[model samples]
Target: MGRILLTGASGFVGGAIHEYLSNSSTHKLTVALRRPMSSLPVTTTLAQIDQIDGVTDWSRALLDSDVVIHAAARVHVMQESSTDPLTSFRKVNVEGTLNLARQAAEKGVRRFIFISSIKVNGEETSLGVPYTACAEPAPADPYGISKMEAEKGLMRIASESGMEVVIIRPPLVYGPGVKANFFNMMKWLYRGVPLPFGAICNSRSLVALDNLVDFVVTCIDHPKAANQVFLVSDGDDLSTTELLKKMGRALGKPARLLPVPSGVLTLAATLLGKKTLSQRLCGSLQVDITKNRELLNWLPPVTVETELDAVAKDFLDKHV
Candidate 1:
């Protein structure tokens, strides 16, 4: 078993990874936290750091690590009032990631696995043409640009230092403890709130929390994952209306959906300054994971239906 160092142990995705690694006997895990945390899932050595910024020192944390899985990043904010949003994102996502990679390489670490977003491709996709691993990057937003730059820097570092770097770009991940848009959708479905997604025939690719964590753990030791960029999903694509209907079934409620024109929805959101959210609902964003499956022989272990039921059950268990 190899010694692994994981960042972002307290966050949603990281917490899932930590729990899975803790339950397994394949690797010894250590987690770096911004503050002291109690009742961690794994029996791991803790390294305390103030923040993951440009100047954060990660030398001590890299002392005896074999692999580094970076799961922490400054996610995109809807209304970022910062004067320089790109610079702020770079400080934590790009600079901080490079700092950790450099330290790990110096300490003889074998691999670095970076958790990236599918936004690196673009916010939306054209109908029927899903993003592939070989697609040229077209990062539109500042957050995507920062992740793209970080990926480039990691590649350069790997070429120079001979440390294997694996980059996995995942679409929206949802499960029992999910938050943000996915969580909001679950809540609305449970409450039987009417939605205007009946006419939104846009396909979206999403990954389950367990599937993402499973792929990440596999990358830690997989020979074919070395120095590669992969796009991961649940291996099933669904339209917006279909997703909501499935969610309603899981919650034991009828999908109270109204058939609304996509144009009208976009115009209304534009007037309300929520154009991005509307686009996300109306536009297609699918990813093709053929390369990962063919190369690594990996498939998502959990189906979307099973995960949605799990999420619905958890929501009811908490609220009822």
Candidate 2:
């Protein structure tokens, strides 16, 4: 078994990846964290890195590590006080990521798997047209731009060195311990709260946490995944109305949706300075996973329905 170095092991998505890696005996896992946690598996090594930024040293952690799975980054913040959001994002996401990758290459790490976001292609997709790996990048926000830049930098490092680089761009990821909008949606669905999204006909592609980890584990050794960018989803696209209805069913509650006009909802959101939130609910953001399926023959191990049930169960447990 080879050694795998995982960064951002204590974060939301990273925490899930850490759990998955720690349980597996296939690879000896070394987790890089800002601070130690109490419940990490006994087999895993905890390497504390004070902060991940432009100058954070990673030489010690990369030594003897066969693969580097980089799941750490400065994700989108709701209320960022930084004067320059792009600069702040670049500091951690771009600069810190490249520094680690370069050091890993120097230290003879065979493969580097980077978990990126679909925002690199833009926030919304046109109806029936899903984002693909070959799409011309049109990053809409500072966070997306930073990820795009990091992708380019990693590819350059891969070219100069022999280290194989794999990039996976995932859409909204949801599962147990999901927070933010998905968590709120589950709570509202569980309580049977009436939502005004019945008329919004937008298709979104989301990935279950398990499915993402499965793919990342596969890429750790898959030869075909090297030097390629992949856009991943659950292979199940659903409209906003369909999502809420399924969520309600998972929660054992009525969908309870009011058929409000999409225009009215958008206008109200605009008046309340929540245009982006409304657009997220009313917009289409689908990704084509044809490459992942055809090349790697990778199918999502967990179904969306199964993951939705897990989310509902977790929410109920917390509320109770």
Candidate 3:
């Protein structure tokens, strides 16, 4: 059994990974958190880290770690408060990640798995032209830029220290306990709120939380996953209208959608200073996962319909 160190046990993606790994018999898991959490399994080891920055010491947590899954980061915020947003993101996502990686390498950690975002590839893509693993980096936002920088630094550390770095970039992970935009969409659908995205034909790729967790666990010991960059999704791409309809079916509520023109929606959003939001709703962003299939022989374990059903059930159970 190998010892695995997991950071960001309190966040959405990290928490899901922690839960999945907690039931595993093959690995000893250590969770690094800003503070102690009462909900973690009793046998789980806790490493308290108040903050993550270039200067934050991770010596205690790096002990005897065979694999380090760095999942914590300064996620994008809707209303950013920092005067210098890029610097703020760099401090936590870039500098903090490299700091942890360097320390993990010194501690003889064999593998470092980084949970990155699809934003590292770019904000959007052509309808049929998906970004592949070898795509040129074109991060458009501060959060994406920070993650890209972190990936570059990790690669350097891997070359210099002989530590394996596996990077997985996933887009719009959704399932149980999802928050923000996805959750809002579920709420709107459940409440029978009519949306103006019925006619949007742009495709977007999304990852199910279970599928992502399964892939990450597989990568923990898979020889082919070492020092590799992977782009992951549900193996299914859906337009906004299709997604809403699927979600409505899952929620047992037929969606009430108005046939609004995409151009008109974009214009309205632009007038209201929500151009980015409109783009996200109307623009296509897809990732090609052929490399993942050929290299690791991996496929998303869960189907989109099944995962969306779970999401709908969870939302109904908790929110209703």
**Highest-scoring model, lDDT:** 3
Ranking by TM-score: 3, 2, 1
Global lDDT for candidate 1?
0.90
- Per-candidate clashes, comma-separated: 0, 0, 0
RMSD vs true structure, all candidates: 1.2, 1.0, 0.8
Q: Once superposed on the true structure, which residue ranges of model 2 sit more than 4 Å away at CA? A: none
The TM-scores, one per candidate, come to 0.97, 0.98, 0.99
Task: List the lowest-lDDT window of 10 residues for candidate 3.
Answer: 35-44
For candidate 3, lDDT tens digit of each residue in 114-164? Answer: 999999999999999999999999999999999999999999999999999
Writing each residue's lDDT as its tens digit, candidate 2 over 182-248 gives 9888888777789998888889999999899899988999999999999999999999999999999
Candidate number that wins on lDDT, 1 or 2: 2
TM-score of 3: 0.99
Residue 294, model 1: lDDT of 93
